[model samples]
Each structure stands twice: as C-alpha cells, then as structure tokens.
Target chain A: MTTAVLQERTHYLNNGYGLKSWLLTKDHKRIAVLYFITISIFFALGGVFASLIRLELVTPAGDLVSSETYNKLFTMHGVIMVFFFLIPSVPATMGNFFLPMMIGARDLAFPKINLLSWYLLIAGGGFAIFAMMAGGVDTGWTFYTPYSTTYSNTYVIATALGIFIAGFSSILTGLNFIVTVHRMRAPGMTWFKMPLFVWANYATGVIQVLGTPVIAVTLVLVFCERVFHIGIFDPALGGDPVLFQHLFWFYSHPAVYIMVLPAMGVISELVSTFSRKPIFGYPFVAFSSVAIAVIGFLVWGHHLFVSGQSLYAGLVFSFLSYFVAIPSAIKVFNWTATLYKGSISYATPMLYAFGFIGLFTIGGLTGLFVAALGIDVHVTDTYFVIAHFHYVMVGGTVMAYLGGVHYWWPKMTGRMYPEGWAKLSALFIFVGFNLTFFPQFILGYLGMPRRYHAYPPEFQVLHVASTAGATVLAVGYILPAIYLAWSLRYGPVAGSNPWGATGLEWATPSPPPTHNFDRIPVVTHEAYDYTAVPQEVEVV
Target chain B: MSSEAHAHAEETLALREQFDTAEQQKDASTLGMWIFLITEIMFFGGMFAAYTIYRSAYPTVFAVASSSLNVTIGAINTCVLLLSSFTMVMAVRAGQMGKRNMIIIFLILTLIFGCIFLGVKAYEWNEKYVEHHMPGQAAFHLEGTPLQGPAKIFFSLYFAMTGLHALHMVVGVGILLTLIVQTRAKKFSAEYFTPIDISGLYWHFVDVIWIFLFPLLYLIDRHLPK
Candidate 1:
C-alpha cells in the first residue's frame, strides 16, 4: 500500500517524452527495457528460424526446403539463437534491470555506457536482420575456414560484423555490471551476503569481459578473410583451419557459461522463493558460479578433442572439463537439497524451475559424456551433440529464462498474468522440449552427423516425432508471448512483494521509480533470509 | 517532506551523505579500474595465446617473420607508447593537483605520441606490403624459407596481433583528444577527474598490451635462418 502510492507518484517515464527520450535516455532501467524489447523481437525471429528447421527435420529428407535453404535455415538459427537470443537473454534484460536494485545502487556504474550497449545491440541486431534479408549466411555459426573464407556466396561479412558489434555490447555490459556489483553495494551488503543471482551474474560478467573480445577479434579476422582474402584461418592460403576452431572455441566454449550462468542465477532465486528456503549451500553456490567461469575457460579444448588437437592437449582439456563439472554439480545438488524438506509450491515459475533442474541434469550429464575423450570421438558433431547443447541451451536456458520472466513479470510491469495458462505453457514447453530433442540423442548415438541438409530414411520416425514435438514447442513458446502482452493491459494489479521474497528489489514499488529509490535503502539483513512467516498488507 | 523544500536542500549540498567518505569512492573506483584492467589482460591474453601456439608450431617461420618485421620501427613505436603512458600518468597527477593547463599539455603530448606510434605502424605495414610478405596475397611465400607453411601462419598472426594493437592505439588517441577538449573546459579538477583517471587506465592497458605484443611478435624466435 505504501509502495503503491510511491509507484503512482514517481513515474519512470521521461519528462521530455519523445523518440529522443527513449533513444538518448541514460537510465539503466530504460536501457534494460530497451534491451527487453529488442531481444524479444530477435527471439521471435530466431524462433521462426528454429521452427523452419524443425519442420524440415520432421522427415529424414529436407522436404520443406532446398539444401541451400536448409543450410541457411540452421545457420540462421545458430547465429540468431547464439548471438542475439541466448547470450544477452538473461543478463542484459533481467540482470540489467535487477543487479543494481539488488545491490542497492541507484544505477549501474556507467549509465550512458549502459545506453550505448543497448544501441550497439540494436545496431548489431539490425545488421543480423539485414544479413538474413540479404539471402542469409550458410556457414553455420562457427564459420569454419575455407568455406567461410572462399566458398560461401552469402553475406558473411554482414553477419560477422553483426556478431562483432554485439560482442562489444556484451563487453560493455559486462564491464558496467562488474563495476556496479563490486563498487555500488549498500553499506551492509557484504560479498557473502549478496544474492546468488548477483554472484552468478558477476561470473557471467567475467566471462563476457574476458571472452567476448577474443570472439570480436576472431570475427574480425573472418570478416577480413572474406573481404580481402587474407589467410588467417583459410587453408588454401596455408592457414591452419583447426586454429580457427581453437580461437573460436576458446571464446565460444566459455561462451556457453556466459549463456548459462545467468540462468543458473535466476533459478537460484526461483528455487529459494517457491521452496521457502534459503538456498542450500549459498556460499558454495556463489563460489561455484565463479569457479565455473574460471574452469570453463580452461576446458575449451574439449570442443577441439576430435578437431585434430594434440593428444596430450585433448587429455588435459578433458580433465579440466571434468573439473568444471564439479562446480555445476555442486549447484545442482544444492538446488535439489534446497527443495528437500522445504515447502515447495508448484507455481508457474516453480514448475519451470523443476523443468530446469531435470533438463539441466540431463544436459550436464550428457556434457560429461562429451567431455570424456573416447565418447567425444564417437559422437562429436553428431545429432547427439546437437541434442546435448539444445538440452542445455533450449531446455535448460530457455526454461529458466521463461520461468524468470514469469517470476519477475509482476515486478517489472506491475501486473500478474493468468497463472493457469502460464503453468500449462511450462508443462507444454517441458514435454515438447523433451520430445523435440530427446530423439536426436538416439539419432546422434546411432551415427547421424549434424549440419547435413538430408538424412537416411531410417531416421524418419524419430524425425517425425521431433517435428510433431516442435509444433507443440511452438505453441508452448507463443502462448507466453500472447499472455504476457495481454497481461500488460488487463491482468490483475500485483502488489509489491507478491512472491513474499526477501531481496531489496521487492522492498521497492512494483515497476520501480526512475531513480530506483526515493531514498536509498540501507540493507541490514542478508539476501534471501526468508525464515519468517509471510505478512499481508492491504492495497491503498 | 515538501517537494520544493527537499529539492532546494538536496541541491544546495556540495556532497551527499550516501558515500560516508571520499576514500570509499576512491577505493571503489580503484577496484573497478583493477577489474577492468583484468579484462583487458584477458583480451590481449587471447591474442598472445594464439601467437604462442603458432610460434611453437613454426619456429623457423616465426623467426623469419620476426626478423622481417621492422624492429627499429616497432621499437620506436614501443617507446612512443611507453612515453605516452608516462604522459597519461602525469595527466592524472595534474588532475590530482588541480592543474588544468598541465593536464591539457600532458594529454596533448600523449595524443601526439599515440599518433606517432600509429604512424610508425602504418609505415611498417606498408613496408611489409612492398616486400610481398603480407599474408594471403600472391606476393606472400615461405618457399626456400625454413619454416615454409608455418612461416605463412607466423605472418598471418603477426599482422593480426599488431594490427589489432594498432587499432587500439588509434582509439586511445581519439579518447585522448576528447579528454583534451574536456580538460580545456575545466570540467575536471582535483575533486573530479574520473574521465581522465579512467582514460589513464585504458591508456596504460593499451601500453601494457603492446609491451607483451612487442616481445611476443617482434622479439620471439628472431635468430633462425631465413
């Protein structure tokens, strides 16, 4: 009731409202909302591309499109999902909106630079869309040499440049978040007391800061090779094609953490809130985020295990890959343990959280399968690999993202959607996701390679199942879009602290004021110390 | 609680009580700078890792490639960048002293030295082009050269590493020019020169990257027969 009055009084919309207000706004929340809209559009575009891929894969043959079109389909899917959707999904949207608020800061360390990051993202997204319109890239997202450098007739330069600019956006966002989290916390908020989401984002920020630039330079090299025929990774000019894989995966392998670590953070909050418990092993979970980020960098060579890497190096990377799993396993065990003996409620967010736990477990275990050198040799570049990553990227990351969106939707927009439909969509997504990707694991195990436009007739049954599942997945995904938009206009008005969560963000009004705080909060208690019974206050 | 009264009182105060002391601000900024520098190290670290792998693979080619690089020009550029780092440090010191003129002078000096570094780099690149040593072109060859294919890899990496470093240097110069303009406006002083301090960190980082680049690209494996 008090916060409701505050919300009505302190509107976040710029006083001088215009295109320039939105465009030139230095507020982090405004920029975050900017990122939210842009990433959603890209996600829809990428979803369309994904659906086309699934439709074609429904049968063993590439029946829906030509080989050239199929190549472009998967390539567009990979490029858009990776650069546009997954990498920026959680961090730029939710992290930007919440990190400063969680830490009791008015804004990120550099607000103008924050705005610049959004612009860069838009410019990059624009370039990517332009590339798609210009008959799309077909070299897969990896852009492996000679094919990318010499053979491809598609718009390689535009796509690579898009990724390059997007990389800078990631770099700047990481820098701002890192600085804000480290420097801008309230007086009593110690590092240990900070929420696990912050810790996870801190780790994600580290990877972004450290890894994005390497990819930026690598993409620039790919661009240069395509434009000027410079032989950085091209084999025809005596370049080592494998080296491109090394350099690309060096950033890209850790990039997997960049995509997942933030989602792990979101799950930490959801599990704790819905289960009504302080996260089990909060310190371990916090440190594990950092540990995963650190060890994730060392294990990139695992991607190159079958890429003709040195035998000794492959073994070293394999061991490191196993080491990286320890931190992830700690997180998974901690989440499960948090749910044990706790009053777990199956809200929409909680259902998706459960989905995340199950799917991410399968994804993580399959990751171990690929991390082991011998098994990797058997399944590298197969549909198994495809399934493994989709489980992590799609099943794990997207589920957590949707869950987070639902969990935070009331806070972000001051309205609550129909909970029943939200839960149904969660179930649909989980079942549809498994149906769509699980068969690929078997297909891949049975010696089917990925990236091919066609396949043997024997795989048709599995393919058809996958296509049917994809149709379900499309519904699962589109429902959220429809409902969330509807909720913006007509859903029940949510009070502050609707979830009864313990964090500074919920301490403020729903859809917080522009400066974020009318008066800066003095955070005296630890994050997520939700041990007391809930208190209900009437709306004003 | 009246809005006008609150606004008048808050605006009139020279500093807010949110930060208990100036030291906290300094500490936070310093920590932020250190974290940022760590990222810069990782950025250059990627390039250095690539160089090491290729250099080990084609030691002879790398050696010839190193020798072919205009070491004299690189050395000069190195000194110019190093000196610019010194000037940048001095600029920060001037800001600390509230000496606007001295800050402007030091920034301009840093900018000049940055231009000189890029100028030398362009000259060296042109020389490589003339010698038919640029990677991926018809003029490029390691035939009769000891390392052969690896040698081509060496030049490819060399161009990439140094070329990227040079681009950063150019960017640093542009940043310095902006700082110079801001300094002339007297926007920064003893109390607030965060822009200069931040730029100094970036400048030092660029310098440090070249410090590693010089040894890794220009000095490594330079003794092998061509």
Candidate 2:
C-alpha cells in the first residue's frame, strides 16, 4: 500500500524554531512532545536507581554498600518510578497529543492550565532532584508512618512536597481531558462509537481527578507531621499510624489503575489494528474501564489486610479485591478474542502488545495470591510481592507504553524508527524482563523479604539471575531511547496514516498542524473499521 | 442553471459558521464546570473521610474537642459564608443581565463576607492557641477531659481539618479578588460569564464543606458530660 496524498499543509514545526516558541506554546501536540522528553529523562534516572538496587542484591551479604545507602536506593527508585515514570507515561504523552484530535477539538478547554500542569511537573521534578542532591529521602514511596514522620533523617519534606505539586499536575491533566472528552466530540461521534483508547483515558481521568487529591492531602499531613512534630501519624503522641495507611492506599491503589488503564487502552487499539478485527465485545471493554476505576476505590483496604485491620474489614476488602479482577479478566479475554483467527500481523507494536498480554496475565494472577488472606500472610513483604507488582506494573504497563509509543511515533514525529531494531528491542525486553522478575517470584516464595541489604546464601542464585536480567533490561530500555531519538532527524518522512489504522488522529497530517484540522471532520463510520478497503489512491 | 448557482452560493456562505449553536457552547461550558467541581469535591472528600473514621472511633474526645470550639465564632463564620454564597449568586446574575456595576457591587460584598469569615476563623484559632489546645504544644492536657488520649486525637484532627479548610478559604478569596479585577476590566459579559459561574460553584462548594465540618467538629460534643 502506498502513502495516500493529503492536502498541502503548512507544518507547525516549521512555524516556530526557538525555545521561546515551545515554552510559550499552547499547542497540545507540542506540549505532549515536551512531556515525552521530560518523562524519558526521569525514567532513565529512575532506572539508574533500580540498577543500583539490583546490583547491591547480586551478592548474599551486604558488601556492596551499607544498609542505609541501600534503603535510599530503593526509596529513590520507588518514588521516581511511581510518580515520574508510570503515572505520567501514557496519559501526559499520548493522551495529551491525541485526545483533542480524537474528539475533533483544536485544543483542550483550558490551554493555559494545560501548560501550567507541565510547569508544575517541572517544578516538582526540580524539587525531587534537589532532594536527591541533598541526601535523598529513605522513606520508601509509601512513606509508611512512624518511619516517615519520625524516623527518617533525610529530606522527606522536600520529596513529599514534590509529589504533592506533581499530584496537582495530574489533577489538572485529568480535568482537561474530562472536559475535552465530554464537550469536544465531533458531530455524530457518540460516546459508544468513540474509540476504546478515549474510553480508557476517560476512565483514567476520573481516577486521576478523584484519587490523586487524597494522596496529596495525605502527603501534606505527613509533611506537617515531619516539620511541626505534629502527632498525626505518630502513636506516641496519640495518632494512629494505621489511619495513614488507610488514607495512603485509598489513593495509591487506584493510582495503579491510573498507571495501567491508559496502557490497556493503547493495547485495545493495537490488538484491533494488527488483528484486522473489530474488538470483540467493545462495550464490555469500554465499560470495564469505568468499572475498574470505580471498583478500584473500594478495594484499597486490601493493602491493609495484614496491617492490623479488623478481621471483618479485611474480609470485605479481600472480597472486593476479587470483584475488581472480574473487569480486568473481561479486558484480557476480550483482547484475546479480538486476536482469535483474524488476519494477524507480527509488527513491532503487535509484538509488544503480545508481550503486554502474557506479562499482564502473570502479574494480575499473582495479585490474586497476594489478595487472598492466607497467602498474603506468608509473602506480604517478600520478593513474591515485588515480582507480582513488577510483572503488572513494569512488565505490563511499560510494555504497553513502549508499544503505544512505537505505534504512534510515526504520527507524532513524522518519522519511522528502524523496524528491525525495534522488533529486536521488544524481544530483548521480554526476555530481560522475565529474567529480572520471574526468579524474584521464586525467591519471594522461598521467604526472601524485600527492602533488605543482605540475605542468606541460599537466595544468591536467584539474586544473581535477577541482577543479570537487570543489565539486559537496562540495555533493552536504552536501545529504543537511542533509536527513537536518532529516527527524528534521519528517518524517512512518515506520511499521514503510516499504519493504515482507523482513528481520528490518523485522519490528519502527521505531526498535526497547530489547529489540528483545517475543518472539523464529520464522523460517519465507526472506529476500527479496518475491514473495508479505501478508494483513494496514494500520492507517493 | 444560473439562477440555481445564486441559491447555492447563498447556502455556502452560511455553511462555514463556527460553534454549532449558542446552547451547544453553553452546555459544553456548563458540563466542564461541573466536572471541575466534582474534582474539587473529591479533593475535600479525602479529608472528610479521614475525619469521619477518626471521629467515630473516639466520639467522646471528639465531643470534648468540639466543646472547646467557639460556637459563636463558627456560627458567625458559617452565616457569613452562606451570605457570601448569596452575594456570589447575585453577582453571577448581574453578569448575566449585563449589569456591570451591580456585578462589581455584589462581588465586592462577597469579598467582604469572605474576609469576615476568615477573620472569625483567625479569632477561633487564636483562642485555641491562647488556651494551649493546639496539638504538639506543651499546653495540651486531657486530665479532666471526658476522653483521655482521644481528646488529643480530636484536637489533632480538629486543627488539620479546619486548618485545611481555612487554607482553601484564603485561596477562594484570592480567586474572588481576581474576578473582581477582571470584572472591572469588562472581561465578562452576559454572553461570557463562565468565570463567575465556576467561581460561584467553587465558593458554594467551600461553603458546603464547612457545613459538613460544622456538624462533625463543632456540634459533635455540644451535649458534653455535666
């Protein structure tokens, strides 16, 4: 298939060529690109922290560094990975770029506020960097009470403040997306007919708006306790530390959905496009996103099952946790059915999509083990829990993120990355990720507790294997960063509709013009209509 | 055929209109404001949930802590806030009716009431400070109180919850001041009063939060042990 001819259009990139233009720009696409770059840097920094952690664990003894340094390493890793990498990865980048175009709007409802979110992210990132430079915080990302409020000698306040500001950034983004999706749809594009990606983002936006603020307030309380010696979370002064956990997870648990839902949305598009089939049970998939968002809130107490919660309350949380999985299962099954006996392609994006399916399955199934009261008691803080979340968060969300990034790179930058290298990196990531995390599951089941600087000699084999996998995973992650950067200047021009996919974004020029469209499109066909052939001829 | 060409030109001229209709624009903006307000509710909802669980667990301490609160100041603040809401509504109505002077007048009235609310809050907080009721201070004691450790819990929550609410009030006042300036500049008209409407929604929301706080904090221990 040849590239189709589009109308001659003036490029937005050529319209401006200075830093000031980008800094002051209201263009959502540019803002998305800006987010992509900023988040990539933070991800690399976070990966470095992870590498230090894995390296320290390569041996049985705590010979690599003191326990204090090790604690700082994991703390920095968790904080950066959760806040800077996972939460903002897909939504700020892909959602910002495509949501407006998907709904036939020129820009978000409040473009200035949209820009303000970026500034907030930067300010927050700066505080985080400052904390790192000024002897990093050691209170693990959860900032579990007593430790965070009273024990930690590091700059907990600085880090917590950073996260608080970043939380507002997310809230603003959610607010923008909600308004855009609600009010900006093109004529005739009903909610049901909208693409599943939009549906997923909409659900995520809801969680972002509602769930993020709880964590913000919790962090504020933590900060106050630290600075003012307030006894909110300190048991010695009449504060209940358990209450802190309840409040923290109330947001953090749904935050996991905030991290994954967008990736799931990305997977829906990739599955349908590559399989050449309309998504099986589209409404189920769409509603499941909403269901997950709502159900996600009720089950946060599952994190407190072993934390001295009332037995009855624990049971309630445990049961609610099981119910949450039903919607997730529906999503996985629908994706599988979408791929059933269709004209399948082994494109790079599809490979990553396939990776997402396999890895997310392992990650999600293991979550059930942790949710079960008896099982969670045995492995609550062990490597088992670590492996379970990494499988879901890193293996699942990150794979889908890379897939979406590759899938949209052509449209986003008007350049195609090297397909062969892309496929090779995808394979390496799968192998390396499995190597790094899969053995942790064994180590966890064998009673190796997480967050320790030292361990018994018996766990060394799995530890070494995990460390080796981290090195490969590091390479796997770095390769795309190199090639994607290289592709921007030297690769062949990606004309509009590089993948021959069906979405409103594909209907416009690659690296879309500032106003998005010369005229708003009137939608007459449903999304993912890949079965029909086109009559228009290629320009090239 | 030439006559038909003239009719076609007339229709074509009308086809390139922006925004489908006025109602469409209004609906979109209104929906956007409501979604934003929902986010605000969620923001405060977190604090409320925390307050609820803690208060339920220690009803006696919460009541004793409530008894210490100056009901006169709190009630006055509440009335001031409710009246501010009324003034804000009138301001929005003035904007809608294209009455610029009335809009400014009511907005100013709303600002005054807001200041009055903050003033009462300051006096109440000062009273707590003077009485050594503030958390983490050396003056905190519960020997004679109905609830032992729970009184401290009550005061801890009391400061955190009301302090956060006061912080929001300050923010709202700043926003209203901005609206006042913008109103003076003639930025809003009958056709474009989104700012006023959204601000009113937010002001009313803050008022609603105080309503919940009053019952939870001020009225929880009104009938204390004699």
Candidate that would win on TM-score: 2
For model 1, give the interface RMSD: 2.9
Model 1 residue runs over 4 Å out of place are A1-7, A13-17, A537-540, B1-33, B141-149, B220-226
Model 1 chain A weakest lDDT span, ten residues long: A531-540
Clash pairs detected, candidate 1? none
Question: Could you give candidate 1's per-residue lDDT for residues A498-530 as a string of tens digits?
Answer: 888887888877777776777777777777887
Docking class of 1: acceptable
lDDT of 1: 0.84
Residue A318 in model 1: shift from native, Å?
2.1
**What are the per-residue Cα lDDT tens digits for candidate 1 across B69-150?**
7778788888888999999999999999989999999998998888888888888888888887876677676544754556
Residue ranges of candidate 2 with Cα displaced over 4 Å: A1-9, A532-540, B1-26, B146-148
When candidate 1 is compared with the true two-chain complex, its DockQ is 0.41
**Candidate 2, residue B220: lDDT:** 73
